[model samples]
Target: MRAIVLGGSFAGLLAARVLHDFADEVTILEPDNEQEHRTRSGAPHRDQLHALLAMGHDQLERFLPGLTEELVDAGAHLGHGEQVQFYIDGKRRPTVPGIRMIGASRALIEAHVRRRVLALPRVQVLPHRATGVRTHAGRVYAITSVTPGGDCHELPADFAVDAMGRSSRLGRWLEAAGWPAPRIERLRIELGYATARFHRGHELPDTVVAHSTPGPASNYLPSVCEPGALTAVEGARWDVVLAGYTGYRPTSDPAAFVNRMRRCVAPIQQVADLCAMEAEPTTFHVRDSRRRHFRELPRLPGGLAVLGDALASVNPVYGQGLTLATLQASALHRHLRCGASPHLPATGYFRRAGAVVDAAWQLSTTADLAQPHVTGPYPFGYPLVRWAADRVTQASILDAEINAAFSDVLHMRQHPRVLTRPRVLLRTARTLATHKITRPT
Candidate 1:
């Protein structure tokens, strides 16, 4: 069997790797030829700081054995427990033991994954722009491709994947081909962030990751403290990013970026004070979070699947995109492993993938709704949900046990509904009551 994957970045690479277990041959379609740790024209946010949530880290390791060791040996930091820090409204949360995360740039992590995936004998990367898929009797059989000079060709395949990030043309193609396009849901966030690299040596020697964002103290507004994150990435550099909503977004100005960092938490402030700026900051804007609901479609072409941003592009500030893609790929593998046919509509696969998307979407969109600038398409019973969620979050900062449960949900290892369990709610209430009683009036 032959499989074709569109886009060769993290999502497509993982899709190709998974397809290798089911198909005899797999080809990745990507136009950019750059093979280094740099952003490609196709992916504007490739160079930004990306987090591999604990579950994403586990999925990556499972897909590519020894990747953690490979990345660590190449200067990427592997942080566990206290080395990974989380702060809300400038106050650091007590560390939870056994929690692990890898500090690395999106580019570095993708480069390594690309190398490992391409090394598979059954897989190969192609320099071609995919136009659309060719369908016959409701099944995809070939993909139309165009060369650099506008020459068109076709590649036959038994299966195809659309990993074409946010700007994917699959929806249009489906409509043009007479199939009902999947319903799309969007939430306008108007989020913007800037990232810059600084030379690293002995600074924050024991730390690998530090992240700070708005909380109840600030009413989830950037006015109280700058929301940003810093990661100890490869090449002995500290990758710092500052984020804001709507009009308060960070800019590319070097001095202004550092000034914003100074308003952040202690770790980011330390980077601003001690580390010399390596270069001008780069900025990216996200106007909205979008998701394509393929499972809702009445009909879909067989032998077709979509992953990554093509399926769901949530708020990047939440750092859920990469992890969501990894989880989707795992879902795809399970669907195929069950002897599901590539020649028929992948109903089972879409069902499983949709469940994964639901989890990440709920987590990100719920938090994004907390921002003052964000308007509603609020979920059902949002007021009550928000109150309960806020209470749990406040308690998590004080108790390690509660934090672990919260972290499990944040990391995508467990469902958000788990927080609603009696045990968790009971602990949250007790913790909050104890803090309330002990505090000075």
Candidate 2:
């Protein structure tokens, strides 16, 4: 069997890696020719702080053994998810431990993953731009693209997968081919971000922090690297990201970015007077959170499928994209494992992937909509979710089991529904009844 993967970034690389197991030859079609694995110009967020959720971290290890160790060997920082200080609505939560995650620049993670995927003998990364899909009797057969020479050609494949990011144009091509465009759920989030690195050399900041505004104000997230973290691979001593939601956005100007980071920067730098900035700040923004409902489509060609952000993109602030993409790739692997025939419908794959996406979509969007400034339809159980989340926040500090459960959900290691178990709910309620909440002034 032959397979072609479009857009050779993280998702594309993962897709090609998974397909390599089932196909005789798997080709990755990408336009970017940058040889190094670090972030390319197409992915601007590479310079910002990034975390591989425990679930994705585990998946990557399953897909590529020794890959995580290779990253640390190459100077990437190894750490646990619980080491970071977490806050909800500007209120601090317990620092639970044991969830495994790695700390590194997003570019570094991509670069390492890219290297491993390209190493597979059956996998090839080609410099090509996929313009459209051509189908035979309603089944996808070939992809048309323009080579580096500017000459257009059609590449035949038994299966074509799209791993293009959020800006993918797959829907348009499908619509042009007489298939109705898939339904989309879009939430106007108006999220803004600015990031920079800082280090005092004498003191290495060791915790990540996010200070989300309590009421109408926007969300603010700032991070500091772990002490003794390997920085040679990422080329930065520390990584900091300042993020906000709604209309509140951090300025890109150095001084303005510093001001936005004030009171919300890393703990060691909270004094501001002590820590020194290392470089000018860069900015990235997201106008909305979007999810393409491909599973709802009445009919989809058998040979084509969408993965990662093309299927669903939520607020990056939640840091679920990479993890969710890995889950989707795993689902694709299972689907292909059942059958390698080109005529096999992708419905089973979409169904499995959608189940995974549903959990992430609900958790992240519910949190994003917690603030009133972001305009969007309330998901079911809105009030109950808020109440439980609040109680969990306060309860996690005092109750270790609750803390462990909440940490599991946050890391995507367990289903969000686990928090709703009778025992956990009872514990949260009891903790809330006895605990008195107070905020430091």
Candidate 3:
């Protein structure tokens, strides 16, 4: 069997890797030439903050052994997820001691994985853009793509997967082919944020630190600090991001960026004041979290599967995109590994991928909707879920077990249901009463 994967990104690369176990030929369609340990021009978020959640690291390790050590050796930082100060509404949470995670730029992670996937004998990359899909008898048979010159070529396929991120063309292709397009779910969040880079030239006091302020003031003041990987490959530089909700936002001026940091996290302000600026602040457009429910549709295509951002995109703030994509890849692997059929079923694969998206979507939307600035209708179980989440955040600050549970869920290592257990609820209630919870000031 042969498979066509669109987009040679983290998700696309992983999909290619997974398909190698089942297909005799796999081609990854990507526009940019793969580069090692460098930033990706296609994904501007590479300039922003991207942390490899504990679960994502674990999966990457499973698929590519010693991958974490390779990244570390290449100047990435590896440490506990709970190794730093976590603040909410300007107050610090009693730090939880031991949840593991790795810190590196998106390019670093993807480069290493790209090298590994391309090393596979069955996988190959085609530096071209897939323009359209040619289907027959309710199944995709070929894809049309444009190469370097003004020329078009059709490549036949047994299976095709979409990992094209936000600019996915599958929906358009599906509509043109007279097939039912996946139902899209959207949560509108008009977010404005600014990011700037600075170099310390020495070890940072902490690996990662975040501070968020409760609104009802001027704007949502949420801040995050992530130092570059600890190795000497990249200097002691840190990525600082500040988000302003509603109409307020940060400035591109280096001086103003530091001033914004002074108002949020403590060490961040010092890092800003002392370090050298790498570049001017880059503004970010926080759009809606969109999910194309392919599983909901009674589809016509038999060999089509959507993965990664092409399938669903949650709020980037949660840091679950990479993890969710790989989970979907793993699901694809499981489906292909099914021995009963020589061909993979589209509906079954979509449903499995949808389950992974559902988890991240639930967690992201629930939290985003709770914010006053985001305009969205109440999801299935709103007020109760919100109330419980609030209590858990507060309770986690004081209770070690609660904190551990919360971290586990946040990292996608456990289900959100873990927070609703009888013991957890009781402890949250107890902590809420006895602990002098400071109202969001």
Candidate 4:
């Protein structure tokens, strides 16, 4: 059997790596020629900060042994949970031991994974622009692409995987091929982001700071790196977004950016002060969080699967996209290991992947909705849910147990259902009561 994976980034590479074990031959279709270092144009934010949560790291370690060691060997910093300080609701949570994460650029993580994937003798990387998929008699037979020489080629394969990023055209290709249109949900938030590398000095603390505003304010997620370098990302809704939603957009000027930094929590402000900018600002435009309901399609063609951002693109602020993709790859491995019929409909995989997407989507979209400017279909009981979340955030500030519980869910190590437990509810109630009792009268 032959398997052809589309896109060579994180998801596509992981899919190709796993497919090699099941298929007789595996090939990856990527447009870029260079693989030694991180390349932009294809993935513009390759040099930006990327966090690998415990869940993602654990999954990668299990799927690809010695992967973490490889990253550490490549100069990636391994930081424990206590070393990283989290500030939420204008209060800093006391850090605890045991929970840990890897801090590095998206390029570094991809480089490590790419090196391993390319090492497989059975796998091949083809540099070409994928045009479309050709299906015949209820099965996908080949992937058509245009080579650099201007020649069109049809690479026949037993199966094909789409790991293309946010701008994937698989939906259009499916529609052009006579497949029913898949349902798409797009929340156009019109957010803008500017990121720059900075050199950290001795005055800066070694930590990661994430500060999210309620609405119309900029949020920052900063990471301190080796050689006293740091990466800072400043994001806000755009002018068009300000006009459409609320008047809240971040400025591109350095001085204004510094002033806005003061609005965030203390730790982030401290980092913002100690670092000297090292690179030109790279800005990004965002359309709201999007998800395509491919699982609901009446008929999905056999021998084809879609993974990664091609499947669902979450708000990058949540840092859950890569982790969810890793989980989906793990799910694919399980399905193949059980000798499941690959030719059957992909509803099962879609449903499973949807679950992963839903968790992250809910967490991110809920936060987006909190911003006064963000407008969308209010999930049922939006007000109540937000109120409850706010209460939980308040409780987390005072209670260490609550902080740990919230952190676990935020890290994707535990499900959101844990937040609804009776014990957590009781703790939240007690914290609220205690706060009220101590209020000035």
RMSD of each: 1.8, 3.9, 3.2, 5.5
Encode model 3's per-residue lDDT on 82-129: one tens digit a residue: 455555555556666666666666777888999999999999998888
- Model 1 lDDT, full chain set: 0.90
What digit string (tens of lDDT, one per residue) describes model 4 on residues 312-363?
8876666688888898898787767777666665566777778888887888
True-structure Cα RMSD, model 3: 3.2
Please name the candidate that would achieve the greatest TM-score relative to the true structure. Answer: 1
Pairs that clash in candidate 2: 37-111
| lDDT to native, each model | 0.90, 0.73, 0.74, 0.69
| Higher-lDDT candidate of 1 and 2 | 1
Residue pairs with colliding backbones in model 1 are: none
Error of 3 at 254 (Å): 1.7
What does candidate 1's lDDT look like per residue over 1-441, in tens digits?
899999998899999999999999999999886867377898879878898999999999999999999999888999998899999877788887877999998988988999999999999988999998888998999999987778898999899999999889999988888898888899999989899999887878878999888887668887567899999998889999989888888999998999999999888899899998886799999999999999999999999999999999999987888999999999999999999999999999899999999988988888889887889799998878888888888888889888899989988999999989999999999999888622211
Best of the two (3, 4) by TM-score: 3
Give lDDT: candidate 3, residue 293. Answer: 77
Highest lDDT against the true fold, candidate: 1
User: What's the distance in Å from true for residue 383, model 2?
Assistant: 2.5
Assess the local accuracy of residue 422 in candidate 4 as a C-alpha lDDT between 0 and 100: 89
lDDT of 1 at 331: 94
TM-score for predicted model 1 compared with the true structure = 0.98
